[model samples]
Target chain A: MALHPYDPVAGAALRNVPLAEVDSKDRSLALSRPWQLRPSLLASIASHGILTPLRLRPKQNGLMQVVHGFRRFEAARRLGLPSIPGLVLASRNLLKLFLQALEEGRTARTLSSLENAAALRTLKYRFNVPEKRLIEEFLPLLDLKENRRTLRLHLDLAVLPDALQQALERGLENETALRLSGRPEDFQSLCCRLILSFQLGKNRQKKLVEMLDEILAAASKQEVQSVEEVWRELGCAALENRADLTPADRWKRILALLRQARYPALSRHQARFDELKAALKLPPPVRLQAPRYFEGSSLEISMTVREARQLDGLARELKRISGSQEWEELFRLL
Target chain B: MQPYKPEKVFVERAVAESVITRNVLGNLPMAQVEWIDEAGQMVDKSRRWNPSIARAKQSLVLARHPGRFFKPCPAGTTKTGRRNVCCNYFVVNFASNCHMECSYCYLQAYLNLPYMVVHANVEDLLDELGQVFSSNPRSHYRVGTGELADSLALDSLTGYSRPLVEFFAGFTNAALEFKTKSNCVENLLQLDHRGRTVVSWSINPPTVVQAEEHKTASFEQRLAAAEKCSAAGYPIVFHFDPLIHYPEWEKDYRSLVEEIFQRIPPRSVPWVSLGALRMPPRLKALVRERFPRSGLPLGELLPTEDGKLRYFKPIRVEMLSKMRAWITAASPQTRIYSCMENTDVWQKVFQSQQPPSEVELGDSLLQLL
Candidate 1:
């Protein structure tokens, strides 16, 4: 069945109705994964207050469908806010409105596949939902409790014989297929074609094995010490493992994988990721901002590449490089 | 629910002076039996700690009862017997239970047990078991000692599960399950009882293991241990009993079942049982006093004929259905059974009017032995 985005009425007049005015007895809240909350984000909202309004559209009932910022909407409600601001789009013009919404959001227009995939999940669960009659919903129909969590390396990737799935789980950018769904055929084809083709000679293979040995040893040791540490170490280890393969190779595999993933929908979500990237790229336009610490200094950043690299080599680098010209140049470029 | 009462209270704690005898008369390795030094042994049966709660009419005995009053032995079949069991099960006494309070344990209620002092003697208990199994080798006695203490709780310091592993090694007639939330299998790692000892572990989601099932090994770690046992050629079992009907049960249960199939191949899963929350009358009262914040026993508890307050049957069936669907998806070949359930639930959820006879299940298990 075809699923169009939920396009509710899009107008400034209907935007800020008190929740009391919206009759919502029969409407189910947008389906979501609860554990996906980022604590720092929540703390930011609680401290500084929500800077952006939550995006929403109307559904069958009077209920407002969360178009985006589901977590922010929830955090606001949890913070005991009386009402929240939202955008309401029409159901008939879902695809166009969704794309437009993205464009308005992601003005810069270039975003990573990872950012795109995350946007898709947020959109699927937090914004547009499949109409009930649609068979085999593209988004796994989660009843609030189910999470679209980051897949474990072993089960989602390593456990499978397919190198593609393994690559995706390791967060390797797959631009080829870039599919999120793990349909057996795509995985098998990629396994036979891409992964098998990538195997190195016996000695390089041995180095890979030795690398795996050291990583596993470190992972095991980290498992005993701290899970967060283990995760960071394994994440770095996984990236290191994937580092041997070039970006072209990674994107090729990612595209091949797009079919088994939520990535393509995300790549198409050019608007949202771009917006976030734009937000990150924009400077405070003021002198004092996120005080970075490097090389015995806790100040603003402006450093040259050499000084930055020197700072990078330092045990405490941020302070040293923060106020350097290189840092400001890097920030401006970023 | 009326506040609390100790089910099997002993006015005096039994001081068992005895040590386990090594009567290994065959090829089976005599276990490395770690005993509570005579000073720690509760030698007197006449002492106040006589723990034998009635499972139907039979009074199951315990030498020394730990004084964690209000230990609720939530009723169930798989909770008692191992393999696809057909029998009654409950905790004899709850005390400083498993040293490792696995994150997924219902024994979070067992925190009430006075921590310290391992209850020593099981020799006479073995004598009772020896009589029952010998007389009814065909009777198919299905029982487990780990429900209260992790069968191997003191296995390292006490090496308890090893002797039972050795003892039950010969009881091809009976099926003894050593259920634990702990990964401490150093004692049972070397034993040769093939299938008589159905080694099992309570499983949880990776997040739960890392978070709530505190101090216990990670889900992968536990699965690795199970895998280790399976590689050493042991048919292992997994239990999702007390399947907490929590947020993201689908994700958590899915993660668990996914890892289970990925880790322990279907051929190795001797049996897997599905259960939902159930609390004894006293446990409801006790856990509230101890874990005032523990929402488990507080929500929607009503009395059952057994004096425990469990979810209404339909609610439990719904809970089990979610679990059953996930298991069915993963390893349909693995024998899936409901623990401590009755006929109607058996028919509806598992599609069985009744579980096969205990003897039949025992025979199937022993064939592996």
Candidate 2:
């Protein structure tokens, strides 16, 4: 359903109007945010500023439907502007007008508060819109240029992890949220906790993603059925990407899963414990796993390089534990 | 008053203020009194050119610091200091200023001058070199004289390269590098072609040379100079050290690498150092504030432990991987290094696995020398 310039914007417009003095109409606000608000979009918008103005129509409720300035809208929002100038489009007119805008080389903002992959797919099929146009053009066009630095088509995909893509749906434009979608269920919560825990440096964040990519890439390239197999597959080169993650965190998680105990995905916790023990001149006794959303099925370990010493240790421990009578009864049937 | 008559020049240097010389000494190597001729050039009054004591003293007084004067270089690290990174190295400054003013240069932050400051006391400089090299003899000392000033900037006047080339000759363990953006190869070409001294050039993508690095020789001219050094039996070095992080960086770097190997055989080239465009921390804001059109993006940046903002580690890793892949394919044996980076990167891109400590790096490079 096309949003009538009368819907959200009209809803926003009439939101503050007193019932006694209110009429339903859309109004536009003129705004531009500070240049730094957009990490990589200023130049594009400035280049865009040279192109053309967005055409938003006015409704009586003082809300405006964005006909353009998708870039400018985010910029203004970043700068804390309440209302932005936008051309209002009634629900009845949005479908044809949107087609006309594209035909005229006049693109509207990528987002019109009408983002839902299911809806977009339906819209694409019904309108015969190209999938690429929806992803490469319309999506980015809808976002204010400032928010586009880290925005990509994944946010438009329904199959991505629900917990991970929540921020994108809430209009929070950040790469951290986008990256978490790829994590197994076990690490999804861990990723968010880490983002909120420490000030993650850009390099740190990039390295983590690259490490995950390397793992995924390795899995796609080879066949593996066992932990040992995964280790052998990773090779030494690919493991360096995860070198920064403490060994203890890595060890404990695999052990806890094998032991059927809850585990934590963040290795930084182990690193902290190690750091304290080191300062105190005490030996690190054992790995600690903080139970949250961790489970072995959530794991997507691959042939990317890793020392896998802990995995080896776990195998040895499993052998010793199973050798005992307490372990014998556990797997006696299997 | 035109000093070098009959020679048309785009820029000229004059005596801004001088205090070192009580009077004039007529024995200075690259200076002379001249009168203007019909071609708007300088004609020397004397038959022989000599720099007087007065001239050397004048150059010194002009270069004096108004305050404490000495601050360590922020983004300055040699292949040795940069050891365990994409390379292991360090750089030193034999001169303090440059006469050429490229709009992109950071010399203004270090020196208080518009004129070149050639260290007149060769003995004191030798003493400093002696102390450094003696203490580091077992290590390969890959040091360059291009930090505070263009290593070859004042060679025409002071003839500093002659002594430097001679100085590094005895210190077989120390690799003395003289880097420049100028084609002042005349003084350098006469050296003994010792394997120790690397005649390096700080070049950029061609159009960058024309636009930002003003008064510098063209890319083709500089490559020809490298070719000349190669023919002299001297191993030459090339640096795209300040590889600008432009929108078209991939195209620019690829073209440069292609041009270099195509023009000068990879064997004749001693090494190539590919550094991302970086500057001292102080200069970042200054450059942005002063040159509004700098247009340099915040490109995958991070602050070093030492505090210089740089291309973050992953970005650097990605950059080096691409660069090393290209170079490794192009000239497999030629040594490639990075300036002032860390050890993890060295291992990742170069496949070094285990890099030497700073001292070990110095010894290894020196042994090669």
For chain B alone, what TM-score does every candidate structure achieve against the true structure?
A: 0.69, 0.73
DockQ of candidate 1 is 0.01
Off by over 4 Å in 2: A1-334, B1-92, B102-104, B112-115, B127-140, B297-300, B351-354, B367-369
Q: What is the TM-score of each predicted model, taking all chains together?
A: 0.40, 0.44
Candidate 1 lDDT for residue A314: 45
- Candidate 2: C-alpha lDDT: 0.50
lDDT of 2 at B205: 78
What interface root-mean-square deviation (Å) does model 1 yield? 26.3
Q: How far out, in Å, is residue A258 in model 2? A: 45
- What's the interface RMS deviation of candidate 2? 16.0
Per-residue lDDT over A167-264 for candidate 1, one digit per residue giving the tens place of the 0 to 100 score? 44333334222322333343334333433345433443333322332333333433553433432333432432387788556535443332212122
For residues A60-110, what per-residue lDDT tens digits would candidate 2 score against the true structure?
566445543444555544444444433344444555654544433323334
lDDT (tens digit, per residue) of candidate 2 on B187-229: 7777774777888888877877765665577787788888887
Mark the 10 consecutive residues where model 1 chain B has the least summed lDDT.
B52-61
lDDT of 1 by residue, B1-369 (tens): 011111222212243343422211111133222233332233243233533221110111223532332212344333324232343332323223444533334454543323223344555456656776687555555566666566644455455566567777787666667676666666677888657777788776765555445556667667777887788667788888767655566787887788789878888786787766667656654554444334454333444434455665545666787788888889877767677655555656766656776446445644544
